[model samples]
Structure formats: structure tokens, C-alpha cells
Target: MMEEDDDVTQGVLLRCLSLYSRGGGCKVGATTSDEFGEIVGKSYKPVCGAQDTSVDCFSYGVEKFRKKNNKKKNFQLQEPNHNNNEMHVFLPDDILEMCLMRLPLTSLMNSRLVCKKWRSLTTTTRFMQMRRDGYYPSPWLFLFGTVKDGFCSRDIHAFDVSFNKWHKIEAEVLKGRFSFSVTSVHDNIYLVGGCSILGKMDRNSSKTHRGVLVFSPMTKSWHKVASMKHARSKPVLGVYKVNSNHLTIKSQHNNFFRTRQRIGGVSDVYEDPHRLSVRRVSRTSFEDQKSKQSKVNKSVKDCRRFLIIAAGGFGSWDEPLDSCEIYDSSSNKWTEIQQLPVDFGVVCSAVVCNGIFYVYSESNKLAAYDIGLGYWARVQTTPPPPQVHEYTPRLVSCDDRQLFMVSVSWCEGDGEIGRRNKAVRKLWELDFEYLTWNEVCVHPDAPMDWNSVFVADKNLIFGVEMFKIFGQVLEFLTMCDVSDPKMNWVHVSKNQVAREMDVSSCVMKSMAVVHL
Candidate 1:
């Protein structure tokens, strides 16, 4: 049942209990004598009847009243029936939020459908921040898939990493877009500009859409937000929070050819000028543009309260572009920061750990960039020894400033000299104090292709795999607990949702881990 609806029911039940607490006197409009008699009839137990206290009777009356009334028609929670002229319960907004915060996440999500007021109250930035601060809802991972079969769809799914439960989020608003950059601020997911279709278009074409869309999981709905001044696809999205204010930091994509086109080396075939854009979406309303503009200017002027950290990424042309820049949200501008070390190769992926940005490549080599001190250092860890065939290692960040490494290796079979991929989904935790990695546990028989990993605060890791095997696409969600020291990988969920589509054609368009 909807939570807001439950609020009304709870009010009535509380009033009924209060009446029974007062020795079952029926005041006018409080409850009819027949209703009081009926409640009394159900409250008394058969054998222990006369010996029970009035408190027990009140509790029983509450249960019976709830069961009886819930089966009836839906009641308007916000308004009391005027024909009966019964008093309705109402609480201040802050009190209401506090009461709502006690509910589980699933109940809170379903509460959005109760009314517009409930939806707005739960979806506000302030409410989301409160939820995070209170740790009301567990952390969840959102996965979005790319377009396939001539249709663009969000294909998004959510998983509660704490309870190992998969959930559904309404993502109709994310349709018709691919490669959109996704990042989370508190409990909301933001989708930036991307190609509306699969095909490539000219960079100067006006057909490109620079719109920004935001989805609040609490409300299970999406809404449009401020758009970027420049169209960006596959941009690096990061959330910069300073002094309790949030500013979305978007690092513009710089094509390797972007510099070449400027020096007259090539014509304007695919020219997307690289630049940074920072948008403040922490506000609940953007209707007052003039006042908002003034507020934005004031905020930008005080930008020195936070320091910006830049992480280098691989360029579009497969060239190693070591350049990086820092965006000062307060100043409403970006400054070119330190370039990566000269030997930094093509970055495969990156994650923030211990307030340091760690960039890793396909090889075992890694470089660390300090966000506060603005210093770069090559992280020294002993790489696995060379073999006849080498498998690329992947990194995942767990809770409590812990880093994990998933090492991949292969084995050769006998006789026919056939090769079999041996993937040990080992969970290794990094000890920052000692600058060492410790093997927590290993799943030696795990599949080679895990699409994504989500880490929970309890040291449980969720690895999801959606791929094809023997012409049949399969989806597998596995969970393992490193904190237990003896736990093995276990399958939590599986499916064949991509039965009609080839696995190779499916791509993960967007994915983000959010703390609810």
C-alpha cells in the first residue's frame, strides 16, 4: 500500500487508540456507539478476555480497524470528509519528512504515487540530502544499456547492493539517447548530452541535442534540467560538493584531432571544440532566472572554498592526451591544471580513492593524482609476472576508502593445445597504510566477462554479467562478501532478457553507483 495513504490510515488508527485509551467513551463524530461496540467485540480475547488490560484492547482495536478499513475504497489523505466533519491529522512539512524517513526505501519509492505534494516533498534536494545524512535508504547501483535493433531505450535497472535485490526504475525519459554521460549527486542521476541516434553526425550540425535530464529514484521519475552551452557526448562527469553545495563538473571531451584542426592540419569534418562546463542544479527551482543569475554569480565569486582536481583520459583518436584542467565552480571558469606524467598511457578507467584520483590502463601500471595537493605520482605495486598470454586487470573501489583489484589470467589445455580462459574473480582489498594489496577471497570458477561491479559498505561486492553463451544471451548477478573472510561467490539472480538479441550487439551505455 502507498505510504501517504498509510499516513491517513495511521491517523485514524491513532485516534481510535486514543479513544480506547480513555476507557471507551464515544464522543460525537469521534466514533459511533455501534463502531465502539464492534471494536470492543474484536478487541476481547476468548479465554484471556476480562484479564487483559486496556492497552492490549487498544492495540487489537488498531489492528482490526486497519484490516477492516484498508479493504474499502481509497481515502483522500490530505483532506478529511466534510460531511462527517471529523478532525483530520496534519503535521508540519519537517515533521512529515521525519515520519516518512522511518519507512524503508521500497515504501518511500512507492509513496511518490500518493499525490503531487508527497512526490515534491520526497524529491526535493533538501530531502535527498537529509536521507543521505541519516543513511535512511541503502546504496543502489543503476545500470543503463545502449540502443539496439533500431530503437533507443534506457533499459535501466537498479540493484540494492545491501540486500541483493534488483529493482525497476521508470526510464522512459532516457529513450532516444546513447553515450549520455551519467553521474549521481546524492540520490539523483543526471544524464548529459549524447547522440539521439546511433549514427554519427557532423559536430557543427544543429540537429544535436544538448539537453540535460535528471532522474530522482526516490520519486521514480525524470525531469529536464539546465542544458549545456556546448554539446558534449561521452564527457567525464563528476560531482563537486563544497560547503554543502553541489556543482556538476563536466570535463569536455578533447579529440586528439581537436588540436590538429586548429593548426590547419584538417578541415571542419568533425570539429567539437573542447571546453569545460559547470552547472549548478542543486536548486529546486529555476523559474526566477534573474534572481538565479545573481545567486549564481555570488556563488561563483566564492569558489575558492573548494579545490578542483583534474583526471586525464584517453583521447578519441586513440592518442595519449595527457592534458587536464580544473574547473573552479565559484569562479564559473576552468583553469588548465597540471598535465599527467609523460609516460601515462591510454587510460582504461579511473576511480577516486582516499581523496586521490587513480588512473589505470589496460596494463597493470597505474598513476595517482592528489586532489588536495595537486601532485602526481606513479603508484608502485608489483605487477603479475609475464605469461604466454596476459590478461588485463581491473580495479574497483569499495566502501571505507578500500580499493579492490580483479585479476584475470588464462590456462592452456593439454593434447590439442587448446586454450581455455581461467578467470579467478579474486577480491583483493588494498591497505592504504601499508601501500599493499591483500587477497580477501577468490572465486576461481567465475565467468570471464563481468559487465560491472558494485561495492557495499559491508564489503559485499555485486558483479553483474549480461552476455551470450552458445547463441543464447544470459544475465547473471553474483554477490560475494569479503568481510566474512570465508564467503564464496554466490549467484543472486539470472535471466535471459536478451534472448532475441546478440550479446555482442549490446553495450552498457551508462552506469552509476549512488548512496541512497
Candidate 2:
């Protein structure tokens, strides 16, 4: 019965649109004699009366059809009557759905206010499915992090790829929590376990929380999902779609030398486009594999295979993990992979590229782990850092293929009478295929100290940082195109009236890109 009603609705809607496009001079089909088609014809009268342009005419026809169809006794209860003069509309629902799928998220959000029909269409499950299936453009970068004020904020800022603009939204439903990891599986952004921000003033007093959050772009809302079994602070998060209906989330807590380790995962099935039905999996699968550590034997150890260690004591706070784990999504388990060489003790950053994990160690060396062969090798082709005393190295993976290494260094140049110290940052792209690094120029005047939460997309990098400009505190939310010849960094947050609000509080913790 429901399918029949849907077919009737579609037929009536398309017929009204056909007549509307011809300026109502054309006749509708014989179905117009039925009650459903009769309401559609009556709805067309008010729509044509409100026509101001071709676009508005089509919109009015669709909106009117939707309004009058609801008045039918079989469909549902009747809606309030709309003034003919005020009947604003756009494309037919089916056509509107297709058009909206191509729009950037910001414009799609604004479209919700156009009329009742648009609002209903944007929030429907079918529309969200379209977004998940790559009908829309590439995802936008979303940053939820801390600023300089020491107060964590629930506010989030997003960068739209279509407009090249950044805008803010109230997203901290976890009550201003920070240190969480953000992962986008399909249409939703999952906020994994991180420390609570409800009341901690200092880092030492902060407490870790196991709460997991899921944000839906369609509804512009956040809701609680399944929490991790172990409380984690600054965990490493990764998401993989097992199939059309299931997702496997792997998260490692920041216990093993701040490098973190995989505890367990929530094997979730899709309950809807925005929500998941989560079930906790046991750690024993990964834990039991630890007992078979000796199976690798002493021969493999001497043959360039490293020993994978288990989590025991909390290593030094200042040290990085010498070991790392590999997550197998097919089995829904994590296995202790390999240990870093004695010469490579601490790692500054790590990223996965081409099915392999690459880590930048504190010793200024690159380590590569191949998942298929289950072994580690050092890459000598990594670009060397600048010859400066104070420097920080970061590894960023852009859109799952391009790998970039960003370095910020303090350089001192000899002056006429003294020495001047200036901050210099450089961008380098690493070609994994050929194992070569090419330095991409960053503008000389670009602000330094870009050591806050940052994200990289296809050609743009979005970073948020606090700086003191002429004794005034300023927070810069910036976007830069590394692929551009000029390598310009644009300040996206400068034009907003609420820019000061961002400076007063709001520190960015983590960033992720979502498709819609």
C-alpha cells in the first residue's frame, strides 16, 4: 500500500512539473481525475499564480504539490494552508534531491530554510545515502580543538571545498572535551574516547573519558554512540567499512609512550545513515596473540624482523613508543606488529600511506612498516630538516594518497650589529611511489608557530593557532594551498564579527574531513 502511494505521489509530482514548465498551458495526464491528481491540479493553480521566474515557477509548483498532497485523507492529516503569494519553492522533490547532492554542505544547510518541502527533503534518509555514495563533492575539513585561553570549547569550524571558506558551528556536545580523535566513516563524524573537559583547569588534573560521539550533517546534531571499554586520552583512531552494513573502528589509547595502543573496538552496524548500533568486542583476540610472540623465533629477529612487545609499564612521559600495533579490520582484531630499532626510540609523528605505516622518529629518521610482509625498514630518502636548534617536524596525509612533511624552525640571521631570530616553516611533498621529497614553498610572510590542530585536503591545508600580534591576542584560522605556485596562506577567520570570540576561547583538538 505504501509503495502504491509513493508511486502515485511521484506520478502526480512529475505531471504537475510538466504542466508547470509549460506555463500551465499543457494538460496533465488522465490520472488528474483521481483524488491524488485532483489535489495536485488544485496545488498547481496557486503555484502558477506565484510564478516570478522560471526557477521560482518550478519551485512553487513543487512546494504547492507537496502542501496539497498532505491535505489528502489517505496520505496523512491536513497541513495549514499557505498563502499563494508566500508559496516559495524550487525544483520538484526528486530533481531537488539530485541538485542538492552537488551543493556544498553550507549551501545545503541554508537550503533547509527555503520551504517545508526542502527541509523535509534534506533530512531524509535517501538524501543522506546520496551523500555517502560520492554523488556530492569531496568532504570538507572539520576542526574541533583548543585555543590559547585554556578553556576547551564545543564550537567547531568547517572548511567548505566548493567556496574555499570556513564557518563555525556549535558542535561540542561532549561539553568542551578535547584530545579526542575524529574519524569519518561515510556521512557521519565519530568523536572517539578522549579526556573530559567539564572541569579540568590544568593538564595534570584532567580525567580521561570513554564516551564516543557521532555527528550528523543532515540533522546538524550530535548524539551518543557506544563508548570504548578503556578510557583513553589522545587515542589514535582509524575507521574501515567492513561492508555496506558494518563498520570497524580501531582506537589506541595514549598509554605506550604517548604513541597509544589499540585496546578494543566497537563493531557497529548501520541502524540509519547517522546512527549506528554498536557492540563491544573482546580484547582477548589481540591479547591472546601476545602469548605467541615467541613463534617469530630468534632466526626471524636476526633476519630484519623486529619483536612486537605488549603493554606493561607506563613508559617515561617524555619518551615515545618504540613499538606499534597493526589493526586487521577483516578479523576485527589488533596484533602487535614490530618494535622500533634501538637507534629509533622516540617518534614525533606517524601516518599510514599506501597500506604501509610511516613514522618520523625523534632522531630525525624515517621508519616504514609494510603490513603485507610484516617487517620494518628505514627510509633514507626523507628530506632532512633545516639546520636550526629549535624545530618541530610533522607528518600529514592529504586525501589518503599525498604525503607531506611540514617543518617549523627558528632561524637566526646575522644582523649589522647583532643576530635576529625568525621563524621559518617549509612544506615538502613525499612521493611514495619513487620515494622522493620535494620542498614546496610556504610564503615568507606566513605566520609561524602553526603547531596547533591542522588538516590537509587535496591541495589545501587548514590550521588554527594563537599568536600575539602587537600585544593583542589573535587566533588565526588559516587556509593555504601548497600546490599553488605562490603558496599563499589566507586568513579565513579574520573577516568574521565573532572572530574575537574564537580568540577568547576555543582550542582545536582534532580535525577530520567528512563527505557531506
Candidate 3:
């Protein structure tokens, strides 16, 4: 209710901001003139504000103006054609932004198209960083519906946690009759191998090839990169930062020690980028992917470039895989990892946290594959996550070592639309490092009959709900802090802000923290 009250309050103030500019004044009868300013001021103070003196002086002016003309008047209407400069009231940018802050995130994001001033505010990295930090928001989720006609396309949607609205982005680079395998590392989308279903001119269509396509909302363009070894399907693209050492060459005159510091983590993925190997038969023997094919790529005394893994997403629904493979960029090859036990099977939904990988079984069980130990052990499932609705679980993301997944029980569950989710919606968490799982439940009943879930940071999960097997209609996202037992699971934005999501270009494969 307080949030709703905030919406009403901001609505009234924004109405005033537009009118406040006109000869007509603003009304504070129901809304406090300084209230909105104070709210937005808090969001910008420490970051966007330059100095205390400037901030203080600007704040005072807005407050003074409010006190002078407290009455509300519509901005669109002229105020008796007054020529007096006395009514020329203006507030500093800092204070005005404070009011804007109070408005819901959806309003704030859409404010970009409102006018030049709003566009400037939305596009600025400083304001964006401030928003991310202050709100502890999650990255956006770009989802695509079903694919057909030998052609596949999905909309790119960003779920802004701060504003709680989903925005649709339409772009040309996403056209193809190909399958999608995507992931979000940083704020970008990595779209991997897909064969075109239709057009003869469709690039990479029909034939399987390994070519990587990437999309970053910040840059808003798709770029191609190296290809993979084989044409793969339903590849679960997991993006993680690889920590490498920062190098510094020292002159012979002075003795230098290896910095061992990292040049910084750049985003890379398990791409099937063998643009050269598309339909070609093996130049070398094709080893079964289920075996542990990872040899010590270089075991060099200096650096061990980390390996990224991909597993069990090939074949048709009836013959889904249990095979897994890892790639070492240093070696430029794919190493098939040890397969899971017959019961555990290959992880249907799993994510890497810190350095450990927590892979969830399709059944009610889960296990951790120790990268260092080279073994996969079965873990117990007490509050067994409700059985995965389909072959895959909703999501798998790690918060430190605490893993979070939104599992569904198909026996029964209804979304807000009064339709039953193929699986009943429920929020579940597990501290994988400790082998402990939280049974406490939260809701906004996920808006999915079948949506790929991605870790949207701690206590939050987001995914796409398809209108059909091929059309995406809605996006489901929610935060369940539950730090206070009293708070069950507050719906951040599902039906409310998600209405603006663009489902057309959603490439069912990618996930973002919050749509930029």
C-alpha cells in the first residue's frame, strides 16, 4: 500500500512538474511539494551530486519555490497571461531528480521517450550505476517465445528491478530461423548456435554450425564471433567471469615480480563457434561428449586458464542427453566432463557460484560437482524442490554459495491470469556449499507454464512465459528477500511493470541482471 501511495504521490507531483513550468502553480493540498524532491534527492545525493555547497543551494531553492506557490494548477492551462517574471520558478537538477526517483521504475524508464531531458537521464551511466547500487536491483531477463516455420525469433526484454517494468527492444540482428542458446554475463547477451528453419538466405539456417552472436542492451547491437565445434541444440549458455593474471613486462635494468593480478574478467561463453566445422565430418575421431574429455589443457606452471562447461541439452525431447562437456579457451578445445550418476542424470537446471557448480537433478535431488575434486556426488533432498515440471527445472543461480531456484509442482498452481502453471509456482533456496536447503515458501506465483529461469541475484528470480509454444506474452520476475520472516515474497513487478516487455525479439536463451 505504501508503494501504491508512492505511485499516487509521484503521479500528482509529476503532474505538477509539467504544470509547475506553466504560469499555473502546483497544488500541495493532497501531495507535499517537497516530498517528491526529498525522495529523489536521497537517490542522487552521494553519487550524482558534485559538491555539498551546490547541492545545498539547489535544494533550498526548490523548497523555497514550493513554499511560495503551494496551490496546484494544471500546467497545460495558461494562467491569465501573466508576464511577471515572479512566477519563473525552477529547481536544481539534483532536487528535481529526487522527485523523479519517487516515481516507479516503469515510469522512470518510459520517461526516456517522454522528452529530451528524460532521455538524457535514462542514458547516463552515472544515473544507471546509482540506480543499480541504491536499489540492489536485478539485471533484466531477455526472453523469446516459440519458434516456427523453419525460422525462430524472440523479443529482447529487460526487467528493471528499480522501476519494476519490463521494456521491449526491437532490433534487426536477431533475425534467423535458428535455435537460441543464450546467457547474460555483465549486462550483455551471448546468443549461440541455431539453424535456420526457413529462408534459403537465412544465415546458418537448417545446417548446424558453430557461430556466436552477442547482444548488449548498453550497446544495442548484435555482433558475431568465433564458432563452436558442433551444431548443438538447447545449449544452456552459462556466463561467468574468468579471473586471469594481469601482466607487466619489466625492463632488464630493474628486477620485476610477476604481478599475478588479473587484467580483469572479460565475458566469454561455451560457444560452438566452429563456423568451419558446421557439416564437416570429424577430421579427428568424435569422442562421446559424456566422457571426461578434459585433459590438462596446459597445466603450465604459470597460468591455468579456467574452463567453461556445457552439458546435456542435445537430441529430441524423448532422447534428451546426460552428456556434459567443458571448454578451455587456452586450449581452444572442448573436453567432455564426467557424466552424472544414472539417477542424478545430467543437470537440467544448474548454475555456477563463486567457484563451485551446483547442478540440480530433474528429480527432487541435486548434487555439486567439485571442479577441483573431479567427482560428482549425490546430495540429499529433504525439502526436495517440487519436481521439475518438464525435463528442466525453472532456474539455477548461486548467491555466494546459497543457490536459488523457483521450482514448480505440476499437480496444482494457478498464475494471476487464473491459468494453471504447468508446474505449481514456489520459491526455493539452498546453501549448496553447506548442503542445506531452505523450505520457506514465497510467491507472485511465477508467470510461467514453461519458462527458463535464471538467477536474478539474491532472493530474486526472473523468466519468460510464452503465449504459445512460439509467442512470448509475459515475463515473470519477483524478489523474495524474506530477511524478515513476516515478509513472504513481495512481487516486485510481474503484471504491473512487466506490461511493457517486448516479446518479439526475445531469444528464449538469454538472461540479464536488469535490463539497462
Q: Against the hidden reference, what TM-scores do the models get? A: 0.61, 0.60, 0.53
Alpha-carbon deviation at 335 in model 1, angstroms: 4.7
List model 3 lDDT by residue over 1-516, tens digit each: 652343233223344344323332222221211111212223421111222111121232244322333455322323465753232333445665554444333334434333345446555766656655455333455554333333454445454555344445555566653455666544456666555444523433255545666675653557765565555656654433444443121221221111112125321111111111322454233333212232431342324344555555554322456655555555555555555546775456667764455566556666655454344446565556556545356555645434566765554543456765554566667643234566566554643445445455554454443332343345445455644565465545544322333443234444546333
Off by over 4 Å in 1: 1-95, 161-165, 170-173, 191-214, 220-320, 326-335, 384-392, 411-421, 431-436, 450-458, 496-506
User: lDDT per residue, candidate 1, 1-516, as tens digits?
Assistant: 664464444333233222333333111221211110111334522111123212132221222223123333332243345565434444357755765565445545434434455557777878876776686676677766544454565566676655555544446666656655666655677776565644432223324445667787665667875555445454443344454245433332433334334465533221211100111332234336547766776666333234333344323332344665554545645545455655766554555654556666655566765554444556655533222124334466655356776664433344455666554556566655344667767664555454443434336666666666786776666677766658688877676234544454244435676766
The best-first sequence of candidates by TM-score reads 1, 2, 3
Question: Can you write out model 2's per-residue Cα lDDT over 1-516, one digit (the tens) per residue?
Answer: 763443334323333333323333112232222110111223421111112112232232333333235232322223367433322223356666766665545445544444445567778877777766655556566766644344676667665545555555665475557666676655577776566545634556666665667787657777875454345555444332221222222223322332322225321211111111111144454345534644633324222112111211112241233545543324433455446545874565566554456677556777665444444566766456562334446677765557787776555664544767877776777854345677776634444344455566656776656544555545556678767788777766643322443343333346777666
Task: Mark the 10 consecutive residues where model 3 has the least summed lDDT.
Answer: 267-276
Candidate 1 accuracy as TM-score: 0.61
Q: Which scores better on TM-score, 1 or 2?
A: 1
User: Against the true structure, candidate 3 has what lDDT?
Assistant: 0.46
Clash totals, every prediction: 2, 12, 44
Local lDDT at 314 for model 2: 17
The residue pairs in collision within model 1 are: 300-330, 303-330
